[model samples]
Target: MNNILNIVKHIEKSIIFILIVFLVAILVVSVVDFGLYFSRLLFYSSLEGWYEPEFLMPLFSSFLIVLIGIELLETIKAYLKDDSIHVELVILVAIIALARKIIVLDYSTMKPEKLYGLAGLILSLSVAYFLIKSAGISMKLRKKSSVDQK
Candidate 1:
């Protein structure tokens, strides 16, 4: 039984390793793609006009995509270290995803209610993130105080 359990553990570790490697590859590809796209946008803007406001939204969206990938990588790292997923990290990823949407929003076409919905979403995520961080800090302080008292 122990040998079978050991085998299972090894397989799990191997799968995680492969996943990490794939994520790193994805991260690299995303960064390279962002660079290429931004350069092309800049080159075209330079040739056509001194300023192009339209390209800025796409650039920010791409940048946020890269950031989301990075946050996933961090979540994986945290899981490997502690064998648990961190809620704060997941919330952060969601916030980044929502921020990306807001950043790329076409104000001319979007409805006012949709804008209000997005604003509410951002506010909720901000509050959740703050509460989680504060809870963690309080827990750590409690643990330290208890240890000192003992």
Candidate 2:
């Protein structure tokens, strides 16, 4: 049984490593693509087009996608090191993703209920993140206080 468990663990780690490699490759390609697109937009497009929503929205969205990828990579690396998932990091990634969605959302096309739903989601995630962070800090403080008493 122990041997079987070990084998499963090894397989899991191998799969995770492969995922990391692929993620890194994808992120590199995305960055290069963003750079080329940006250069074209800047040098080829007119000055008026620079501030246009159609052009700027995609550009910012792409940038945020890259950032989100990096954060995911960090989360995976941390999981590998600690052998546990970090709730805080996961929540943070969720918040960033929500922010990206909100940024690129077209308010004109969106319904009122949809907007309200998104607002609720944002509030829930924000509160969850705050609570998680506060709990971590409280734990650390308790540990310190206990050590001081000792």
Write down the TM-score of every candidate.
0.77, 0.87
- Give the lowest summed-lDDT range of ten residues in model 1: 138-147
The sequence of per-residue lDDT tens digits that candidate 2 reaches over residues 1-150 is 656766776797899899999999999999998999899988888868567799799899999999999999988897777666777788889999999999999999999999999999999999988998877642111112222344
Per-residue error at 33 for model 2, in Å?
1.0
Instruction: Go through the candidates in order and give each one's C-alpha lDDT.
Output: 0.80, 0.84
Candidate 1: tens digits of C-alpha lDDT, residues 9-120: 6686688888999999999999999999988876765646434557577788889999999998998787676656777888899999999988887799999999999999
RMSD of 2: 6.6
Stretches of candidate 1 exceeding 4 Å from the true structure: 1-6, 47-52, 136-150
Q: Which ranges of candidate 2 are over 4 A from the true structure?
A: 137-150
Model 1: residue 23 alpha-carbon error in angstroms = 1.3
Residue-level error in angstroms, candidate 2, position 64 = 0.7
